[model samples]
Target chain A: MTATAAPFRAKRVLPGFTLSLGTTLLYLVLIVLIPIAALILKGAEIGPAAFWAIVSSERAVAAFRITLTAAAIATAFNAAYGLLMAWVLVRHDFPGKRILDALMDVPFALPTAVAGLSLTALFSANGWFGQVLHPAGIPVVYTIWGIALAMAFTSIPFVVRTVQPVLEDLDPSLEQAAETLGATPWQVFTRVVFPAILPAWLAGCTTAFARSLGEFGAIVFIAGNLPFETEIAALLAYIRLEEYDYNGAAAIALVLLGFALVLLIVSNILQSWAARHREATR
Target chain B: MSAPDMIAPGSAATGHGRPARTMGARALIGLAVILTLLIVVAPLVYIFARAFSEGWQVYASNILDPAMLHAIWLTSLVAVIVVPLNIAFGIAAAWAVAKHRFPGRGVLVTMIEIPFSISPIIAGICYLLLYGRQGLLGPWLGEVDLQVMFALPGIVLVTMFVTAPFVAREVLPLMQAQGTAQEEAAVTLGASGWQVFRRVTLPNIRFALLYGAVLCTARAVGEFGGVSVVSGNIRGQTNTLPLHVELLFNDLNAVGAFAAASTLTVIALVALILKAVLEGRRG
Candidate 1:
C-alpha cells in the first residue's frame, strides 16, 4: 500500500461545532461534575473506616432495609399490574380506552408531595378507603404499606410505558400460529408473546425499582418518618444533613448512589439486549 | 420458493389475525381498569375533593392567603429561571453529542443522565456539602457575604440539576435519527451557523424541545426533595408551592394544605394535557 500523508485536520460541514461543543462541555462540568466531585471529596475526607461505620450503624441499616423492602414490594406489584395494563391497552378496545391511556401518565406529571398528601388523606382512618380498610385491621398510613403504595403510585408509568410500545409493535402472526397449532390462549401468551417482551418488561421493572428506591417526597408524608421502621434511606440522608452531620449524610448518599448506578447499568444492558433480540427476530 | 409461493393461502386469508376477545380477556381488562382507577385516579380526585371540602369560600380564602401566594410566586420564579437554563444546556449537549462524533461522547451522555438515577435528596446534599455555611466554599462565601445554601440560588441550582436531562434526553434521539444531512445541505447553500440551527434544526426538534420544556416546567414547579433540603423551608420566602403544602399540613391545616396542593395539581394537569397532545401529534 502506498502511504500518502494524511490530512492534518478533518473537515466539518456543520458550523458552531466549537461553540456548541465547548458550551456543552463547560456547562456539564460546572453543573453536574463539580457538585458530584465535591460529594466524593467530602466522602473521602471521612476516610473508609468512618464512612463504613456510619453506613453500617443500626439506624442507617434499618433505613436501607426498609427502603429496599418497600421498593421491592412496590416493584413486584407494578410488574404484574403494569403488564396487565399494557396488555389491555394494546389488545382490547373500549369506549374510554384513550382516557385510560392518557391517565397512565398522571403519576409522572403530578407532584410527589401532592401525591403524598392526597394518598395520606385518602388512607387516613377518617378517609374513604381507610374507613373501609382501617376497621378491618389494615393500617396503611405511617406503615411500610404506605411507603410501598406511594412507590407503586409514582412508578406505575415506567412499566406500562416501557411495555406498551413493545406490545403495540409486536407481530400478531406468531400468536396466531400458536393458536392454529392448537395452543391455548394462556400458552400462546406465556410461550410466544411473553418471551418477545420479557427483556423489555424486566428492564422496565428494574427501572421502576430503582426509581422507587430513590423516591422521597411521596413517601415522607405517608411514612411518618419513624426511625428504624418507615424511614427511607433518602429521607435519612436528608435528616442527617439537617442535623449538620455532613459525613453521615455523604456516607448514606454514597450507598444510594451506588445502588442507583448499578441498577441503571443493568437496565441499560437489558434495554440494549431487548433491542438486539427484536432486530434478530425481525 | 418465490415470495408469493412461500405464503400459505390460509395465512394470507387471515389478514392481520386479531384474537377474538374471550370472556376471560374481558374480565381481565375490567379488572385492570378498576385497578387503574383505584390506584391512579383516586388520589387525583381526592386532592380536588379535599380542597373544596370546606366549601369554595374556604378554598378560595386559603389560596388567597399571603404565605400561599408567596409560595406560588417562589415556585414560579424557580421554574422560570431553571427551565431556560436547562433548555440551553440540553440543546448544547444534544447538539454536541448527537450532531458530532467525538471522543468521550458516551461519557458525556452518561454524566448528563446521572441525575436521573441519583436521588434528588442526594443531589441537594451535594450542593449542601459544597455551599452550606460549614461547607468547602462556605468560608469563601461568608467572606463575600453570599448565601448559597438555604436560599434562592441553592433552590434553583438543585432544581436545575434534577431537571437537567429532560430536554437533552428528548431531543438527542430525534436529532440522531434525523441526521445532519439537512443542516449540511443548508450550510452548503451559504447559510450561516445560527441560520442553519434556526431554520433547519430548530423546526425539526421544536416539538420535542417543547415536550421537554413542559416536563422540565412540571418538575421544577413541583420539585420538593431537593428544594426542601436547600430552601430551609423558610415561610413566605424560600417555600415553594410543594414545600408550602408540606408546611400547611405540618401545621395541621389539612384544608389549607389541600388547597395549595390543588394549585400544583392544576399545573400538573395542564402539563399532562400538553404532553399528550404533543405525543399524539408526533405519533
Candidate 2:
C-alpha cells in the first residue's frame, strides 16, 4: 500500500498483487476451487434427506469402517517400515545399497491398476505368496490383509521421504557425544535420536495415512469389496456413480475430503511441534 | 561444538558399555534388504512372470495388435496434451507462491494440493458435475453443442485436474530454497517476465520440471478413477491403455488385460527412472 516502500518489498520477488496474487488466484480457480465447487454444487441438486440417506446407508458405513481401519493399520505399519528405511538409507551402506534405495519409489511409480492386479495375482489362493500361506490358513487377497497390504504398498514412500531429509541433515557428532557420555545406547537413541526424528516421522505417517485413506485403484482388484466386509469407501463411491446416483457419490467424496483436510491440519500441527521441540532441545 | 565439545571429565575414556555399532549397521542393512525385496522386487517378478508365461508369441500378438496400438496412442495423446499444460500450470503457480510470499499463501498452497488429497474418483465426479448434461455449465456448453462428459475433452480436463500439483509441488520448495536472487538479477537487466523464466529460472528448475512431467505423465497414463467417469470406455476411441486393460479384464481376456497393463508398467518404470535420476541430482 505504501508507494515509497513499494520497491523495497516488491523488489524481493515478483511483487505486487496485480501479478503474483492475480496468477495465484487464477491457478487455484482453474485447478482446485472450480473443480471442487462444481462437485459440491452438483451435489446440492439433491435434497438434504437424500444426501444423508445415501451417505449413511449400511453399505456406506461398512465401507468407511473398513477403509479407515485398513488405512490406519497400513499407515501405522508404514511408519515403522518407513522409519527403518530412512535410517538405513541415511546411515548404512552395503551391497546393492543404491538399488535398494531405488526400490523405495517402486510403488509410487507403478500404475495403480497394474499394482492392484499384480498384488491380487501374488496373493490370490493359487498365487506365490498365497500358495505358501494358504496351507497355513493365512489368506491375503479378497480379505482385510490384502486391503492393508495394498494400501501399505502405495504409501511406503511418503513416510520414508518425509524422514529421509531430516535424517540426512542429522549430525553424527551429536550421537558420538552422547555415546562418549556414560549414557547407554538405548538412552542415547530414545533420549536424543528418536526424539529429533519424531516430528518428521509423524508428518510422514500422516501423509501415508491420508494417502491410504483415499486409495481406490490399488485396493479395488485386491479387495473383494463385499458390502459390510472388504469394501472400501472409494469402491462404494464408484458403485454409486455406476448406479447413476451422483448425490450419493458426492456425499461420500465430501466426507472423504473433510477427513483429509482434518488429518492434514492435524499433521501440520504435529510437523510444527516437531520442529519446535527439536529447537527447544537444542 | 559448544558444551558438547567441552568434554566432560573422563567421559571419553569411560569404559561404560556402548552400543555395538557394527551390530546395528548389519541389522539395519539386513532389514532394509528384506523389506525392499518383499515390497518392491516380489511384485515385479510376479507381473513379469506373467509376461513370459504365455510365451513370446502371445506377447508379440498383443503388442502388435491395432486395438492395442490405438489404446497406446490415445494414452500418448492424452499425456502429450496433459503433461505440458500441467507443467505450465505448475510453473506459474510455483513461481507465484514459492518465490513471492503473498497474502493467502497458505490457502493457495492448500488449494494447489487438493487434487493430491482428494480421491481420483472424486476428481472424476467433479468433472461429471461440471460438464455433465445436468451440470451448472451444462446449459452453456449445450449452446455451443460442446459435449465434454464421456468425451476426449472431459478425459483431458480430468487428467489435468488430477495431476495439477506435481510440477508445482516439486518446483515450489526448490524455488523457495533458491530464493529470488537469480531471477531478480535477470529482471534488473530488464528481462521481461517471460524472459526471466525462459533464460534464468527455467534452466535452474529443469530437473524439477522433468520430475514433475514424469509424475504427471504417469498419473495421466495410468488414470482410471477420474477418466472412467468421463470416458464412456469407447474401445479404440476413448479407451486409454488403462481402460483397455480394465475392459479386457472385465471381458475375461486375462491375457489381453495383463498384456495391455504390461505396457503401462513399462511406462511407469520409465517414470521410476526419471524420479530416481531427478532425486539423485537433487540430493
lDDT, residue A251, candidate 1: 94
Error of 2 at B151 (Å): 1.2
| Highest-scoring model, lDDT | 1
Residue pairs with backbone overlap in model 1:
none
lDDT value, candidate 2, whole model: 0.78
lDDT by residue for model 2 (B118-217), tens: 7788888887878888777889999999988888899898888888877777787778888888888888888878788788788888887888788788
Could you tell me which residue pairs clash in candidate 2?
A: none
Q: For candidate 1, what is the DockQ-based docking class?
A: acceptable
Note each model's CA RMSD in angstroms: 6.1, 6.3
Candidate 1, superposed: residue stretches over 4 Å from native: A1-9, B1-20
Task: State how far residue B59 of model 2 sits from its true place (Å).
Answer: 0.6
lDDT of each: 0.86, 0.78
What candidate 2 gets wrong by more than 4 Å, as runs, is: A1-24, A43-47, A182-184, A278-282, B1-21
